[model samples]
Target: MKKVFTIIVLWVAVVGSMTAAEPVKLLTYNIKGHGMTDSRLDDIAAVINAQTPDIVALQEVDNRTFIGIKHDYLSELAQATGMHSSFFALVGSYYGVGLLSKTEPLSVQTQSFDPSDTSKDKEARGFLIAEFEDFYFISTHYSLNADDRDTATAWAINFARKSDKTVFIAGDFNAQPTYRAMVTFKNNGFSILNNTSAYTFPADGPTSCIDMIISYCSELGQEYDVAETGVVTSVNGLTLSDVSDHLPVYVVIDPIEESGVNNATETREMRLVRTSGGFSLSSLQAESMVNLYAMDGTLVDSHWVDNGEEVCFPASCRNGLYLVQVKNGYQNSTFKYILNH
Candidate 1:
């Protein structure tokens, strides 16, 4: 029994000239249980205030634990930075992950991940979601176990799929970019927004990249552009290693405006149909330029297509996932496709 499958994704579309909105700055950090003294807390707040992020995801936070001297670390940070905060306990009311934002969230929700096994040694991990007017921000701490990390990734993806607004997730994933969990995120439509080459762990002399910020926009017609991204190793004149064990990572995003001169009042449409040879594109705009790229970003083929014309895949193209970018006048759109031969 031979089977063949061709999967096409028509969800992502960009049709208009993009206008820059007020960029949203997001930060993620693991503060090593917020240190042990008030001075340490002040140092952490200094780093955060210097960055001036709109939203912050904090991991390894302590809340009135025996070691924390009954102090709420997240509350202290929120007060110090003049931002709203929410905490989701992962190990009773003692340890957890938290979120701090400049504006109050519209709503907040939390969920605990399922343990990998029935072992008391396994640490509990959870995620918190805060809904804003235009997007949803998530803060989470994934378990060290691979199975548990996969579970957490699946949970986040399911949650994002059900949301109507754009989704941004940040946390100490405890997995590298090449890890299975990270690959799963990309397969589900999320894109890692931070630089993977930079390390974030062991703030003193980082060598591992375990903390990350990723985003997914479920809306087919909406798009966001990354304006800036960085791994914060120092704040002002102070080195961040003195305050936390992991460096903070931040990303600035600008929403792309959907209205532009080209096809502003018309609906632009394109279709990819599987053929006996490979595949063909139909219904493209007049003088549309098409580019085929492998998942690894290698250009496979390109062509200038016209309305009612057919553009077939190159014979040298392999069986795998690819990106098809079509440009017509001022309009541009990207589509994901999978070919199994």
Candidate 2:
């Protein structure tokens, strides 16, 4: 009896240590290309900071050549949010996939899945993997076509299977949860984070679900709890002001260590994504009203502006949410963004 008790105690100690050492707070965001008209890097940072995710996977990043400023988009994001950054160029020119982390990742890897030899655009797809002590995170974007998405999903699952480690995958899949590709992810041990199937594409006019965050665990016993998962509705009351066509998906995982954790609310920086449409007056005003009554009365965002500084034009006012409010009897504005995955 004494020996059996000692063995049980030892096993409990080992289990406790493993659970406590696991990384917490992982996230994925598709920051639309960092470019001139859509310079919402600060806004993206704000959203990221608000979530306080330890690991982040990003898609549609600009290398600075074709996009806005001639600065590395991932680097700018890391600096702004005080996080580490890594990238894998898929198109060669500017567009690519990237990873960002507040907690330093142990092992980072980037792989290109482009099979077409036609050109950069035809071949612009890849994955970014970053590992924490016991968790591995992957971020990627899939082709709009069903066939192409299948190939991407296969590659993603194979990579995750290569290790028995706990894994998380996030990005703009461009495929719905009911799609066969998503089913494959589940069969391979990855489960979708969001319980309800919510639309993520076309941030303003989301019609169907696309973006996602998937996780892999042994079973329900060793499984990580999804604290919260849904479309990120607003930033500091700005409401996602058409930052992109796709609404951002936010997912939080509970670490084995803590329970009943509350999400932290913080003022976010700004990010602008360049798009076809020009800026909106709403993007330049403070304390403006933002409404997204698209089939759901629950989706709402509004805010009052405390600062009244013009966010500048042909530079700062890219694809994102701008604050408009009365300041010194003049209208001032700040900016944020939603990257369409």
TM-score of every model versus the real structure: 0.70, 0.64
Give candidate 1 regions above 4 Å deviation: 1-20, 65-68, 118-121, 220-222, 260-341
Residue 281 CA displacement from its true place in model 2, Å = 42
Off by over 4 Å in 2: 1-23, 34-39, 65-69, 116-121, 218-222, 237-239, 256-341
Whole-model Cα lDDT of every candidate shown, in order: 0.78, 0.61
Q: Note each model's CA RMSD in angstroms.
A: 15.4, 16.3
Error of 2 at 250 (Å): 2.0
Q: In model 2, what lDDT does residue 294 have? A: 18
Q: Mind giving the per-residue lDDT tens digits that candidate 1 earns over 27-64?
A: 99898884457777888899899889999999988866
lDDT of 2: 0.61
Residue 196 lDDT in model 2?
A: 30
Model number with the top lDDT: 1
Q: Per-residue lDDT for 185 in model 2?
A: 79
Candidate 2 C-alpha lDDT tens digits along 181-268: 9877766656666533356667776777778877765322233555445567677844565454556676666555323433222122
Which candidate leads in TM-score? Answer: 1
